[model samples]
Target: MSVPSGLPQDTPVAGGEQRVLRFSIAATAVVAALGIVFGLMSGSYAIVFDGIYSLADGATSLVALLVVNLIAGYNASGSQNRRLAEKFTMGFWHLEPMVLGATGLLLSGAAVYAFINAIGSFLTGGRPLQFGQAIVYAIATVLISLGMAWYGRRANRHLRSELVAMDIRGWLMSAAITAALLVAFIVGLAIQGTSLEWMSPYVDPAVLALVCLVIFPIPLGVVRRALEEILLVTPTALKQHVDAVAQAVVERHGFLSHRAYVAKVGRGRQIELYFIAPAGWPARTLEEWDALRDEIGEAIGDDSPDRWLTIAFTTDREWAE
Candidate 1:
Protein backbone atom coordinates (compact mmCIF):
# COMPACT_ATOMS: atom_id res chain seq x y z
CA MET A 1 0.00 0.00 0.00
CA SER A 2 1.19 3.52 -0.79
CA VAL A 3 0.05 6.98 0.27
CA PRO A 4 1.14 10.05 -1.63
CA SER A 5 0.61 13.52 -0.23
CA GLY A 6 -1.19 16.11 -2.33
CA LEU A 7 1.31 17.68 -4.66
CA PRO A 8 1.48 21.45 -4.62
CA GLN A 9 -0.14 23.17 -7.58
CA ASP A 10 1.32 26.64 -7.22
CA THR A 11 4.75 27.60 -6.00
CA PRO A 12 4.05 31.01 -4.50
CA VAL A 13 6.18 33.82 -5.86
CA ALA A 14 7.15 36.40 -3.32
CA GLY A 15 5.90 39.83 -4.43
CA GLY A 16 9.01 41.51 -3.06
CA GLU A 17 11.25 39.24 -5.12
CA GLN A 18 9.64 40.30 -8.40
CA ARG A 19 9.77 43.94 -7.38
CA VAL A 20 13.44 43.67 -6.42
CA LEU A 21 14.40 42.03 -9.71
CA ARG A 22 12.50 44.61 -11.75
CA PHE A 23 14.21 47.41 -9.87
CA SER A 24 17.58 45.71 -10.33
CA ILE A 25 17.02 45.34 -14.07
CA ALA A 26 16.13 48.99 -14.40
CA ALA A 27 19.14 50.08 -12.37
CA THR A 28 21.45 47.80 -14.37
CA ALA A 29 20.30 49.33 -17.65
CA VAL A 30 21.03 52.83 -16.43
CA VAL A 31 24.43 51.85 -15.01
CA ALA A 32 25.39 49.94 -18.15
CA ALA A 33 24.63 52.93 -20.37
CA LEU A 34 26.60 55.21 -18.13
CA GLY A 35 29.55 52.79 -18.05
CA ILE A 36 29.73 52.49 -21.85
CA VAL A 37 29.38 56.23 -22.51
CA PHE A 38 31.88 57.20 -19.84
CA GLY A 39 34.34 54.45 -20.81
CA LEU A 40 34.38 55.69 -24.40
CA MET A 41 34.75 59.34 -23.36
CA SER A 42 37.59 58.48 -20.96
CA GLY A 43 39.19 55.89 -23.28
CA SER A 44 39.22 53.32 -20.45
CA TYR A 45 38.84 49.66 -21.40
CA ALA A 46 38.21 48.90 -17.73
CA ILE A 47 35.11 51.10 -17.73
CA VAL A 48 33.98 49.47 -20.97
CA PHE A 49 34.36 46.06 -19.35
CA ASP A 50 32.30 47.21 -16.39
CA GLY A 51 29.52 48.29 -18.75
CA ILE A 52 29.64 44.98 -20.60
CA TYR A 53 29.40 43.09 -17.33
CA SER A 54 26.36 45.12 -16.32
CA LEU A 55 24.74 44.38 -19.68
CA ALA A 56 25.29 40.63 -19.27
CA ASP A 57 24.02 40.70 -15.69
CA GLY A 58 20.90 42.55 -16.76
CA ALA A 59 20.20 40.07 -19.52
CA THR A 60 20.45 37.09 -17.14
CA SER A 61 18.27 38.88 -14.57
CA LEU A 62 15.59 39.32 -17.19
CA VAL A 63 15.70 35.61 -17.87
CA ALA A 64 15.45 34.90 -14.14
CA LEU A 65 12.35 37.09 -13.83
CA LEU A 66 10.67 35.25 -16.67
CA VAL A 67 11.45 31.87 -15.15
CA VAL A 68 10.05 33.01 -11.82
CA ASN A 69 6.81 33.99 -13.53
CA LEU A 70 6.67 30.73 -15.45
CA ILE A 71 7.17 28.66 -12.29
CA ALA A 72 4.49 30.61 -10.51
CA GLY A 73 2.02 30.31 -13.38
CA TYR A 74 2.52 26.81 -14.75
CA ASN A 75 1.06 24.59 -11.96
CA ALA A 76 -1.47 27.08 -10.67
CA SER A 77 -4.94 25.73 -10.00
CA GLY A 78 -7.47 26.39 -12.77
CA SER A 79 -4.67 27.40 -15.13
CA GLN A 80 -6.08 27.76 -18.63
CA ASN A 81 -2.92 26.70 -20.42
CA ARG A 82 -3.43 22.96 -20.65
CA ARG A 83 -0.69 22.60 -23.25
CA LEU A 84 1.81 24.29 -20.94
CA ALA A 85 0.85 22.10 -18.04
CA GLU A 86 1.04 18.99 -20.18
CA LYS A 87 4.47 19.89 -21.51
CA PHE A 88 5.92 20.67 -18.07
CA THR A 89 4.04 18.41 -15.70
CA MET A 90 6.92 18.31 -13.23
CA GLY A 91 6.67 22.04 -12.66
CA PHE A 92 9.42 24.64 -13.32
CA TRP A 93 11.65 24.01 -10.32
CA HIS A 94 14.43 22.71 -12.57
CA LEU A 95 14.68 26.04 -14.37
CA GLU A 96 15.90 27.74 -11.21
CA PRO A 97 19.24 25.91 -11.20
CA MET A 98 19.68 26.38 -14.93
CA VAL A 99 19.29 30.12 -14.66
CA LEU A 100 21.68 30.28 -11.70
CA GLY A 101 24.31 28.23 -13.51
CA ALA A 102 23.99 30.30 -16.66
CA THR A 103 24.30 33.54 -14.74
CA GLY A 104 27.49 32.32 -13.04
CA LEU A 105 29.04 31.11 -16.29
CA LEU A 106 28.19 34.32 -18.14
CA LEU A 107 29.67 36.54 -15.46
CA SER A 108 32.76 34.38 -15.13
CA GLY A 109 33.32 34.35 -18.90
CA ALA A 110 33.07 38.14 -19.06
CA ALA A 111 35.63 38.48 -16.30
CA VAL A 112 38.03 36.16 -18.11
CA TYR A 113 37.68 38.09 -21.37
CA ALA A 114 38.26 41.40 -19.61
CA PHE A 115 41.27 39.94 -17.81
CA ILE A 116 42.83 38.93 -21.12
CA ASN A 117 42.28 42.39 -22.58
CA ALA A 118 43.73 44.03 -19.51
CA ILE A 119 46.80 41.82 -19.73
CA GLY A 120 47.29 42.65 -23.42
CA SER A 121 46.97 46.36 -22.72
CA PHE A 122 49.45 46.08 -19.85
CA LEU A 123 51.96 44.24 -22.06
CA THR A 124 51.62 46.92 -24.75
CA GLY A 125 52.56 49.59 -22.15
CA GLY A 126 48.89 50.32 -21.40
CA ARG A 127 46.58 52.98 -22.87
CA PRO A 128 45.93 56.61 -21.87
CA LEU A 129 42.72 57.50 -19.98
CA GLN A 130 40.95 60.74 -19.08
CA PHE A 131 41.15 60.35 -15.30
CA GLY A 132 38.59 63.08 -14.57
CA GLN A 133 35.80 61.40 -16.59
CA ALA A 134 36.63 57.95 -15.24
CA ILE A 135 36.63 59.24 -11.66
CA VAL A 136 33.22 60.86 -11.97
CA TYR A 137 31.75 57.73 -13.54
CA ALA A 138 33.22 55.42 -10.92
CA ILE A 139 31.92 57.51 -8.00
CA ALA A 140 28.40 57.66 -9.37
CA THR A 141 28.36 53.97 -10.31
CA VAL A 142 29.69 52.97 -6.89
CA LEU A 143 26.97 54.88 -5.08
CA ILE A 144 24.20 53.47 -7.22
CA SER A 145 25.50 49.92 -7.04
CA LEU A 146 25.85 50.06 -3.25
CA GLY A 147 22.35 51.42 -2.83
CA MET A 148 20.91 48.67 -5.02
CA ALA A 149 22.88 45.97 -3.19
CA TRP A 150 21.60 47.21 0.14
CA TYR A 151 18.03 47.35 -1.12
CA GLY A 152 18.20 43.86 -2.61
CA ARG A 153 19.69 42.42 0.57
CA ARG A 154 17.10 44.07 2.75
CA ALA A 155 14.26 42.80 0.60
CA ASN A 156 15.72 39.30 0.59
CA ARG A 157 15.62 39.19 4.37
CA HIS A 158 11.94 38.37 3.94
CA LEU A 159 11.94 37.10 0.37
CA ARG A 160 14.83 34.58 0.77
CA SER A 161 14.86 34.24 -2.98
CA GLU A 162 17.88 32.82 -4.80
CA LEU A 163 17.36 35.09 -7.81
CA VAL A 164 17.27 38.18 -5.65
CA ALA A 165 20.31 36.94 -3.72
CA MET A 166 22.28 36.47 -6.94
CA ASP A 167 21.33 39.97 -8.09
CA ILE A 168 22.45 41.34 -4.75
CA ARG A 169 25.84 39.70 -5.19
CA GLY A 170 26.10 41.21 -8.67
CA TRP A 171 25.44 44.70 -7.32
CA LEU A 172 28.01 44.26 -4.57
CA MET A 173 30.57 43.04 -7.11
CA SER A 174 29.90 46.09 -9.31
CA ALA A 175 30.26 48.44 -6.38
CA ALA A 176 33.59 46.89 -5.42
CA ILE A 177 34.91 47.10 -8.98
CA THR A 178 33.92 50.74 -9.36
CA ALA A 179 35.24 51.66 -5.95
CA ALA A 180 38.60 50.16 -6.87
CA LEU A 181 38.59 52.07 -10.12
CA LEU A 182 37.89 55.28 -8.20
CA VAL A 183 40.89 54.75 -5.95
CA ALA A 184 43.16 53.90 -8.88
CA PHE A 185 42.00 56.95 -10.81
CA ILE A 186 42.77 59.19 -7.82
CA VAL A 187 46.27 57.76 -7.56
CA GLY A 188 46.80 58.09 -11.31
CA LEU A 189 45.67 61.74 -11.17
CA ALA A 190 47.91 62.52 -8.15
CA ILE A 191 51.04 61.11 -9.85
CA GLN A 192 50.44 62.83 -13.22
CA GLY A 193 52.99 65.62 -12.71
CA THR A 194 55.40 63.77 -10.40
CA SER A 195 58.38 61.51 -11.04
CA LEU A 196 55.87 58.63 -11.19
CA GLU A 197 54.15 60.25 -14.20
CA TRP A 198 55.46 57.39 -16.34
CA MET A 199 53.08 55.03 -14.48
CA SER A 200 49.87 56.90 -15.42
CA PRO A 201 49.16 54.92 -18.60
CA TYR A 202 49.53 51.57 -16.80
CA VAL A 203 47.19 52.48 -13.94
CA ASP A 204 43.95 51.69 -15.73
CA PRO A 205 45.07 48.30 -17.01
CA ALA A 206 46.63 47.37 -13.68
CA VAL A 207 43.46 48.14 -11.75
CA LEU A 208 41.32 46.31 -14.30
CA ALA A 209 43.50 43.23 -14.07
CA LEU A 210 43.34 43.31 -10.27
CA VAL A 211 39.57 43.67 -10.24
CA CYS A 212 39.19 40.81 -12.70
CA LEU A 213 41.37 38.58 -10.56
CA VAL A 214 39.27 39.27 -7.49
CA ILE A 215 35.93 38.65 -9.22
CA PHE A 216 36.73 35.75 -11.54
CA PRO A 217 36.47 33.11 -8.83
CA ILE A 218 33.51 34.59 -7.02
CA PRO A 219 30.81 32.88 -9.10
CA LEU A 220 32.29 29.41 -8.91
CA GLY A 221 30.41 28.71 -5.67
CA VAL A 222 27.06 29.43 -7.29
CA VAL A 223 27.98 27.29 -10.27
CA ARG A 224 28.90 24.36 -8.05
CA ARG A 225 25.62 24.57 -6.11
CA ALA A 226 23.62 24.76 -9.34
CA LEU A 227 25.39 21.72 -10.68
CA GLU A 228 24.54 19.73 -7.57
CA GLU A 229 20.86 20.58 -7.90
CA ILE A 230 20.84 19.86 -11.62
CA LEU A 231 22.36 16.45 -11.05
CA LEU A 232 19.72 15.72 -8.38
CA VAL A 233 22.39 15.00 -5.82
CA THR A 234 20.97 13.62 -2.61
CA PRO A 235 21.29 16.25 0.04
CA THR A 236 23.08 14.75 3.03
CA ALA A 237 21.10 16.55 5.70
CA LEU A 238 17.78 15.73 4.10
CA LYS A 239 18.74 12.13 3.54
CA GLN A 240 19.80 11.80 7.15
CA HIS A 241 16.58 13.32 8.38
CA VAL A 242 14.49 10.97 6.29
CA ASP A 243 16.46 7.97 7.54
CA ALA A 244 16.00 9.01 11.13
CA VAL A 245 12.27 9.37 10.65
CA ALA A 246 11.97 6.00 8.94
CA GLN A 247 14.06 4.34 11.64
CA ALA A 248 11.86 5.69 14.41
CA VAL A 249 8.72 4.56 12.64
CA VAL A 250 10.09 1.05 12.09
CA GLU A 251 11.09 0.72 15.77
CA ARG A 252 7.79 2.04 17.03
CA HIS A 253 5.72 -0.31 14.86
CA GLY A 254 8.12 -3.32 15.11
CA PHE A 255 8.56 -3.40 11.32
CA LEU A 256 11.20 -5.66 9.75
CA SER A 257 13.12 -2.82 8.07
CA HIS A 258 12.71 0.44 6.13
CA ARG A 259 14.18 2.24 3.18
CA ALA A 260 14.33 6.00 2.65
CA TYR A 261 15.24 8.00 -0.39
CA VAL A 262 15.58 11.75 -0.68
CA ALA A 263 16.74 14.24 -3.31
CA LYS A 264 16.60 17.99 -3.62
CA VAL A 265 16.00 19.86 -6.86
CA GLY A 266 16.27 23.60 -6.63
CA ARG A 267 14.01 24.59 -3.75
CA GLY A 268 11.99 21.37 -3.97
CA ARG A 269 12.50 18.37 -1.72
CA GLN A 270 11.49 14.89 -2.89
CA ILE A 271 11.23 12.18 -0.25
CA GLU A 272 10.09 8.56 -0.37
CA LEU A 273 9.91 6.13 2.52
CA TYR A 274 9.21 2.42 2.40
CA PHE A 275 8.49 0.26 5.43
CA ILE A 276 8.75 -3.54 5.30
CA ALA A 277 6.11 -5.30 7.40
CA PRO A 278 6.91 -8.69 8.94
CA ALA A 279 5.41 -11.78 7.35
CA GLY A 280 1.95 -12.79 8.77
CA TRP A 281 1.48 -9.29 10.30
CA PRO A 282 -2.13 -8.20 10.56
CA ALA A 283 -3.18 -5.90 7.74
CA ARG A 284 -4.48 -2.43 8.60
CA THR A 285 -7.21 -0.58 6.77
CA LEU A 286 -6.30 2.03 4.16
CA GLU A 287 -7.28 4.81 6.55
CA GLU A 288 -4.92 3.52 9.23
CA TRP A 289 -2.06 3.34 6.71
CA ASP A 290 -2.75 6.89 5.55
CA ALA A 291 -2.72 8.08 9.15
CA LEU A 292 0.68 6.44 9.61
CA ARG A 293 1.94 8.25 6.51
CA ASP A 294 0.63 11.49 7.93
CA GLU A 295 2.47 10.84 11.17
CA ILE A 296 5.71 10.24 9.26
CA GLY A 297 5.21 13.46 7.28
CA GLU A 298 4.74 15.52 10.39
CA ALA A 299 7.83 14.00 11.97
CA ILE A 300 9.89 14.98 8.90
CA GLY A 301 8.55 18.54 9.11
CA ASP A 302 9.17 21.17 6.35
CA ASP A 303 5.62 20.75 5.11
CA SER A 304 5.83 23.25 2.32
CA PRO A 305 4.56 23.38 -1.23
CA ASP A 306 8.05 22.56 -2.37
CA ARG A 307 8.05 19.17 -0.62
CA TRP A 308 6.96 16.01 -2.46
CA LEU A 309 6.42 13.15 -0.03
CA THR A 310 5.52 9.49 -0.63
CA ILE A 311 5.14 6.75 1.98
CA ALA A 312 4.64 3.04 1.36
CA PHE A 313 4.14 -0.14 3.42
CA THR A 314 4.44 -3.71 2.20
CA THR A 315 4.62 -7.18 3.76
CA ASP A 316 7.07 -8.50 1.16
CA ARG A 317 10.68 -7.33 1.37
CA GLU A 318 10.84 -7.22 -2.41
CA TRP A 319 8.09 -4.65 -2.54
CA ALA A 320 9.76 -2.44 0.07
CA GLU A 321 13.06 -2.73 -1.74
Candidate 2:
Protein backbone atom coordinates (compact mmCIF):
# COMPACT_ATOMS: atom_id res chain seq x y z
CA MET A 1 0.00 0.00 0.00
CA SER A 2 1.07 3.60 -0.58
CA VAL A 3 0.17 6.89 1.09
CA PRO A 4 0.36 10.06 -0.95
CA SER A 5 2.45 12.76 0.69
CA GLY A 6 2.47 16.46 -0.08
CA LEU A 7 5.75 18.15 -0.86
CA PRO A 8 6.31 21.80 -1.70
CA GLN A 9 7.79 22.54 -5.08
CA ASP A 10 10.52 25.17 -5.43
CA THR A 11 8.59 27.51 -7.69
CA PRO A 12 10.73 30.55 -6.89
CA VAL A 13 13.89 28.81 -8.04
CA ALA A 14 12.15 27.69 -11.20
CA GLY A 15 11.07 31.25 -11.94
CA GLY A 16 14.60 32.50 -11.39
CA GLU A 17 15.93 29.86 -13.77
CA GLN A 18 13.47 30.88 -16.46
CA ARG A 19 14.45 34.52 -16.12
CA VAL A 20 18.14 33.67 -16.54
CA LEU A 21 17.43 31.58 -19.64
CA ARG A 22 15.37 34.37 -21.22
CA PHE A 23 18.20 36.81 -20.63
CA SER A 24 20.65 34.35 -22.20
CA ILE A 25 18.41 33.85 -25.22
CA ALA A 26 18.20 37.59 -25.83
CA ALA A 27 21.93 38.04 -25.44
CA THR A 28 22.62 35.08 -27.75
CA ALA A 29 20.43 36.55 -30.48
CA VAL A 30 22.24 39.87 -30.41
CA VAL A 31 25.64 38.20 -30.44
CA ALA A 32 24.69 35.88 -33.28
CA ALA A 33 23.48 38.76 -35.41
CA LEU A 34 26.65 40.72 -34.76
CA GLY A 35 28.84 37.70 -35.55
CA ILE A 36 27.21 37.18 -38.97
CA VAL A 37 27.36 40.84 -39.92
CA PHE A 38 30.96 41.28 -38.79
CA GLY A 39 31.96 37.99 -40.40
CA LEU A 40 30.64 39.15 -43.78
CA MET A 41 32.28 42.58 -43.44
CA SER A 42 35.63 41.11 -42.37
CA GLY A 43 35.53 37.95 -44.50
CA SER A 44 36.26 35.66 -41.55
CA TYR A 45 34.80 32.16 -41.64
CA ALA A 46 35.62 31.71 -37.96
CA ILE A 47 33.34 34.61 -37.06
CA VAL A 48 30.57 33.20 -39.20
CA PHE A 49 30.93 29.83 -37.55
CA ASP A 50 30.73 31.47 -34.12
CA GLY A 51 27.49 33.11 -35.12
CA ILE A 52 26.04 29.85 -36.39
CA TYR A 53 26.99 28.09 -33.20
CA SER A 54 25.35 30.80 -31.14
CA LEU A 55 22.19 30.51 -33.21
CA ALA A 56 21.98 26.78 -32.59
CA ASP A 57 22.74 27.29 -28.90
CA GLY A 58 19.94 29.81 -28.67
CA ALA A 59 17.51 27.36 -30.24
CA THR A 60 18.42 24.71 -27.68
CA SER A 61 18.07 27.19 -24.84
CA LEU A 62 14.59 28.02 -26.07
CA VAL A 63 13.68 24.36 -25.96
CA ALA A 64 15.19 24.05 -22.47
CA LEU A 65 13.08 26.96 -21.27
CA LEU A 66 9.91 25.28 -22.49
CA VAL A 67 10.77 22.06 -20.70
CA VAL A 68 11.49 23.96 -17.50
CA ASN A 69 8.11 25.67 -17.68
CA LEU A 70 6.30 22.41 -18.26
CA ILE A 71 8.05 20.77 -15.32
CA ALA A 72 7.37 23.67 -12.98
CA GLY A 73 3.73 24.11 -13.97
CA TYR A 74 2.87 20.44 -13.86
CA ASN A 75 4.71 19.66 -10.65
CA ALA A 76 3.38 22.57 -8.65
CA SER A 77 1.23 21.42 -5.76
CA GLY A 78 -2.51 21.93 -6.23
CA SER A 79 -1.86 22.95 -9.84
CA GLN A 80 -5.08 23.47 -11.75
CA ASN A 81 -3.48 22.40 -15.01
CA ARG A 82 -4.42 18.79 -14.66
CA ARG A 83 -4.48 18.32 -18.41
CA LEU A 84 -0.68 18.13 -18.62
CA ALA A 85 -0.36 16.01 -15.52
CA GLU A 86 -3.09 13.70 -16.73
CA LYS A 87 -1.55 13.29 -20.12
CA PHE A 88 2.01 12.93 -18.80
CA THR A 89 1.37 10.75 -15.82
CA MET A 90 5.05 9.85 -15.48
CA GLY A 91 5.92 13.55 -15.21
CA PHE A 92 8.18 15.74 -17.39
CA TRP A 93 11.48 14.46 -16.03
CA HIS A 94 12.11 12.41 -19.17
CA LEU A 95 12.08 15.54 -21.31
CA GLU A 96 15.11 16.89 -19.45
CA PRO A 97 17.42 14.15 -20.72
CA MET A 98 16.05 14.38 -24.23
CA VAL A 99 16.79 18.09 -24.34
CA LEU A 100 20.27 17.57 -22.90
CA GLY A 101 21.04 14.83 -25.41
CA ALA A 102 19.82 16.93 -28.32
CA THR A 103 21.83 19.96 -27.20
CA GLY A 104 25.01 17.92 -26.83
CA LEU A 105 24.61 16.19 -30.20
CA LEU A 106 23.79 19.42 -32.01
CA LEU A 107 26.74 21.29 -30.54
CA SER A 108 29.11 18.38 -31.16
CA GLY A 109 27.96 18.09 -34.76
CA ALA A 110 28.52 21.79 -35.31
CA ALA A 111 32.01 21.50 -33.94
CA VAL A 112 32.79 18.58 -36.22
CA TYR A 113 31.44 20.43 -39.25
CA ALA A 114 33.45 23.51 -38.37
CA PHE A 115 36.58 21.41 -37.95
CA ILE A 116 36.15 19.92 -41.41
CA ASN A 117 35.57 23.34 -42.96
CA ALA A 118 38.62 24.73 -41.18
CA ILE A 119 40.72 21.89 -42.60
CA GLY A 120 39.42 22.50 -46.08
CA SER A 121 40.13 26.23 -45.82
CA PHE A 122 43.66 25.55 -44.51
CA LEU A 123 44.32 23.24 -47.45
CA THR A 124 43.09 25.92 -49.87
CA GLY A 125 45.91 28.28 -48.77
CA GLY A 126 43.76 29.97 -46.09
CA ARG A 127 41.91 33.25 -46.63
CA PRO A 128 42.93 36.80 -45.76
CA LEU A 129 40.56 38.76 -43.50
CA GLN A 130 40.27 42.37 -42.31
CA PHE A 131 42.12 42.02 -39.04
CA GLY A 132 40.89 45.41 -37.73
CA GLN A 133 37.22 44.48 -38.17
CA ALA A 134 37.74 40.94 -36.93
CA ILE A 135 39.65 42.11 -33.87
CA VAL A 136 36.95 44.65 -32.96
CA TYR A 137 34.23 42.01 -33.28
CA ALA A 138 36.20 39.44 -31.30
CA ILE A 139 36.91 41.87 -28.43
CA ALA A 140 33.27 42.84 -28.12
CA THR A 141 32.11 39.23 -28.30
CA VAL A 142 34.66 38.09 -25.72
CA LEU A 143 33.47 40.70 -23.23
CA ILE A 144 29.83 39.84 -23.72
CA SER A 145 30.39 36.11 -23.58
CA LEU A 146 32.49 36.37 -20.43
CA GLY A 147 29.85 38.49 -18.73
CA MET A 148 27.12 36.02 -19.60
CA ALA A 149 29.17 33.07 -18.42
CA TRP A 150 29.83 34.75 -15.08
CA TYR A 151 26.17 35.61 -14.66
CA GLY A 152 25.06 32.07 -15.45
CA ARG A 153 27.52 30.53 -13.00
CA ARG A 154 26.54 32.94 -10.23
CA ALA A 155 22.83 32.28 -10.69
CA ASN A 156 23.30 28.53 -10.86
CA ARG A 157 24.96 28.49 -7.43
CA HIS A 158 21.54 28.57 -5.79
CA LEU A 159 19.48 27.09 -8.63
CA ARG A 160 21.67 24.02 -9.33
CA SER A 161 19.67 23.44 -12.48
CA GLU A 162 21.02 21.14 -15.19
CA LEU A 163 19.69 23.30 -18.02
CA VAL A 164 21.23 26.40 -16.53
CA ALA A 165 24.47 24.54 -15.90
CA MET A 166 24.60 23.42 -19.51
CA ASP A 167 23.93 26.99 -20.57
CA ILE A 168 26.73 28.19 -18.34
CA ARG A 169 29.09 25.76 -20.01
CA GLY A 170 27.93 26.99 -23.41
CA TRP A 171 28.62 30.57 -22.44
CA LEU A 172 32.08 29.68 -21.18
CA MET A 173 32.83 27.85 -24.40
CA SER A 174 31.72 30.89 -26.38
CA ALA A 175 33.86 33.15 -24.27
CA ALA A 176 36.91 30.96 -24.75
CA ILE A 177 36.38 30.79 -28.50
CA THR A 178 35.97 34.53 -28.81
CA ALA A 179 38.99 35.18 -26.62
CA ALA A 180 41.09 32.91 -28.84
CA LEU A 181 39.80 34.73 -31.91
CA LEU A 182 40.75 38.05 -30.36
CA VAL A 183 44.31 36.82 -29.76
CA ALA A 184 44.60 35.40 -33.26
CA PHE A 185 43.28 38.62 -34.80
CA ILE A 186 45.76 40.69 -32.77
CA VAL A 187 48.69 38.55 -33.94
CA GLY A 188 47.50 38.79 -37.49
CA LEU A 189 47.24 42.58 -37.11
CA ALA A 190 50.72 42.89 -35.57
CA ILE A 191 52.40 40.84 -38.31
CA GLN A 192 51.09 42.97 -41.19
CA GLY A 193 53.85 44.39 -43.54
CA THR A 194 56.46 42.12 -41.90
CA SER A 195 58.17 38.86 -42.97
CA LEU A 196 55.62 37.05 -40.74
CA GLU A 197 52.79 38.83 -42.55
CA TRP A 198 52.55 35.84 -44.89
CA MET A 199 51.33 33.79 -41.89
CA SER A 200 48.35 36.10 -41.22
CA PRO A 201 46.09 34.32 -43.68
CA TYR A 202 46.60 30.96 -42.01
CA VAL A 203 45.86 32.15 -38.46
CA ASP A 204 42.07 32.09 -38.71
CA PRO A 205 41.71 28.57 -40.03
CA ALA A 206 44.42 27.15 -37.74
CA VAL A 207 42.81 28.71 -34.64
CA LEU A 208 39.37 27.59 -35.78
CA ALA A 209 40.60 24.03 -36.19
CA LEU A 210 42.20 24.06 -32.72
CA VAL A 211 39.04 25.53 -31.10
CA CYS A 212 36.87 22.90 -32.76
CA LEU A 213 39.10 20.14 -31.44
CA VAL A 214 38.76 21.52 -27.92
CA ILE A 215 34.99 21.93 -28.15
CA PHE A 216 34.01 18.70 -29.86
CA PRO A 217 34.73 16.55 -26.79
CA ILE A 218 33.32 18.91 -24.18
CA PRO A 219 29.68 17.89 -24.69
CA LEU A 220 30.33 14.17 -24.66
CA GLY A 221 29.98 14.10 -20.86
CA VAL A 222 26.49 15.56 -21.07
CA VAL A 223 25.60 13.12 -23.80
CA ARG A 224 26.73 10.16 -21.74
CA ARG A 225 24.70 11.31 -18.74
CA ALA A 226 21.61 11.91 -20.86
CA LEU A 227 21.88 8.48 -22.40
CA GLU A 228 22.10 6.91 -18.92
CA GLU A 229 18.91 8.64 -17.82
CA ILE A 230 17.14 7.81 -21.08
CA LEU A 231 18.00 4.18 -20.59
CA LEU A 232 16.60 4.25 -17.01
CA VAL A 233 19.91 3.01 -15.67
CA THR A 234 19.83 2.45 -11.95
CA PRO A 235 22.09 4.92 -10.26
CA THR A 236 24.60 2.97 -8.21
CA ALA A 237 24.67 5.37 -5.28
CA LEU A 238 20.90 5.66 -5.07
CA LYS A 239 20.45 1.92 -5.44
CA GLN A 240 22.95 1.22 -2.67
CA HIS A 241 21.26 3.66 -0.33
CA VAL A 242 17.82 2.18 -1.02
CA ASP A 243 19.10 -1.33 -0.45
CA ALA A 244 20.68 -0.31 2.85
CA VAL A 245 17.44 1.26 3.99
CA ALA A 246 15.43 -1.78 3.02
CA GLN A 247 17.83 -4.12 4.79
CA ALA A 248 17.66 -2.05 7.94
CA VAL A 249 13.89 -1.98 7.78
CA VAL A 250 13.72 -5.75 7.37
CA GLU A 251 16.05 -6.37 10.30
CA ARG A 252 14.28 -3.91 12.60
CA HIS A 253 10.81 -5.21 11.78
CA GLY A 254 11.85 -8.91 11.66
CA PHE A 255 10.59 -9.29 8.11
CA LEU A 256 11.49 -12.37 6.08
CA SER A 257 13.21 -10.29 3.39
CA HIS A 258 12.86 -7.14 1.28
CA ARG A 259 13.13 -6.13 -2.35
CA ALA A 260 14.21 -2.68 -3.50
CA TYR A 261 14.14 -1.20 -6.98
CA VAL A 262 15.64 2.19 -7.77
CA ALA A 263 16.32 4.30 -10.84
CA LYS A 264 17.14 7.90 -11.56
CA VAL A 265 15.84 9.83 -14.59
CA GLY A 266 16.93 13.43 -14.89
CA ARG A 267 16.09 15.07 -11.57
CA GLY A 268 13.57 12.42 -10.62
CA ARG A 269 14.32 9.43 -8.41
CA GLN A 270 12.01 6.43 -8.51
CA ILE A 271 12.20 3.88 -5.66
CA GLU A 272 10.08 0.92 -4.79
CA LEU A 273 10.53 -1.13 -1.58
CA TYR A 274 8.70 -4.26 -0.67
CA PHE A 275 9.00 -5.79 2.80
CA ILE A 276 8.15 -9.47 2.92
CA ALA A 277 6.37 -10.20 6.16
CA PRO A 278 6.32 -13.68 7.78
CA ALA A 279 3.77 -16.14 6.47
CA GLY A 280 1.69 -16.08 9.69
CA TRP A 281 2.40 -12.53 10.89
CA PRO A 282 -0.27 -10.61 12.76
CA ALA A 283 -2.23 -8.23 10.51
CA ARG A 284 -1.91 -4.54 11.15
CA THR A 285 -4.40 -1.73 10.50
CA LEU A 286 -4.05 0.55 7.49
CA GLU A 287 -2.74 3.36 9.68
CA GLU A 288 0.04 1.15 11.05
CA TRP A 289 1.15 0.19 7.57
CA ASP A 290 1.17 3.83 6.49
CA ALA A 291 3.24 4.77 9.54
CA LEU A 292 5.78 2.08 8.61
CA ARG A 293 5.97 3.45 5.10
CA ASP A 294 6.57 6.90 6.49
CA GLU A 295 9.34 5.58 8.68
CA ILE A 296 11.03 3.96 5.71
CA GLY A 297 10.65 7.11 3.63
CA GLU A 298 12.19 9.27 6.32
CA ALA A 299 15.08 6.89 6.60
CA ILE A 300 15.68 7.03 2.88
CA GLY A 301 15.76 10.84 3.06
CA ASP A 302 15.54 13.28 0.10
CA ASP A 303 11.86 14.10 0.49
CA SER A 304 11.24 16.18 -2.57
CA PRO A 305 8.74 16.61 -5.38
CA ASP A 306 11.12 14.80 -7.71
CA ARG A 307 11.15 11.70 -5.60
CA TRP A 308 8.62 8.96 -6.44
CA LEU A 309 8.70 6.52 -3.53
CA THR A 310 6.40 3.59 -2.84
CA ILE A 311 6.58 1.09 0.02
CA ALA A 312 4.56 -2.08 0.39
CA PHE A 313 4.34 -4.91 2.94
CA THR A 314 3.10 -8.38 2.08
CA THR A 315 3.42 -12.01 3.25
CA ASP A 316 3.54 -13.43 -0.27
CA ARG A 317 7.10 -13.32 -1.67
CA GLU A 318 5.69 -13.84 -5.14
CA TRP A 319 4.25 -10.33 -5.12
CA ALA A 320 7.61 -8.70 -4.50
CA GLU A 321 9.51 -11.03 -6.83
**Candidate number achieving the greatest lDDT relative to the actual structure:** 2
- Model 2: weakest 10-residue lDDT segment is 1-10
Q: For candidate 2, write residues 1-321 as lDDT tens digits.
A: 643332224478888989999999999999999999999999999999999999999999999999888888775656565675777777888899999999999999999999999999999999999999999999889889989999999999988888999999999999999999999999999999999998988998999999999999999999999999999998999999999989998899899899988877777788888888988888788888888888899999988777888888888989898
Q: Model 1, residue 221: displacement in angstroms?
A: 0.8
Q: Can you list the residue pairs that collide in candidate 2?
A: none
Q: Candidate 1, after superposition: displacement of residue 297 in Å?
A: 1.0
Give the CA lDDT, 0 to 100, for residue 304 in model 2. Answer: 78
Compare the candidates by TM-score and give the number of the best one: 2
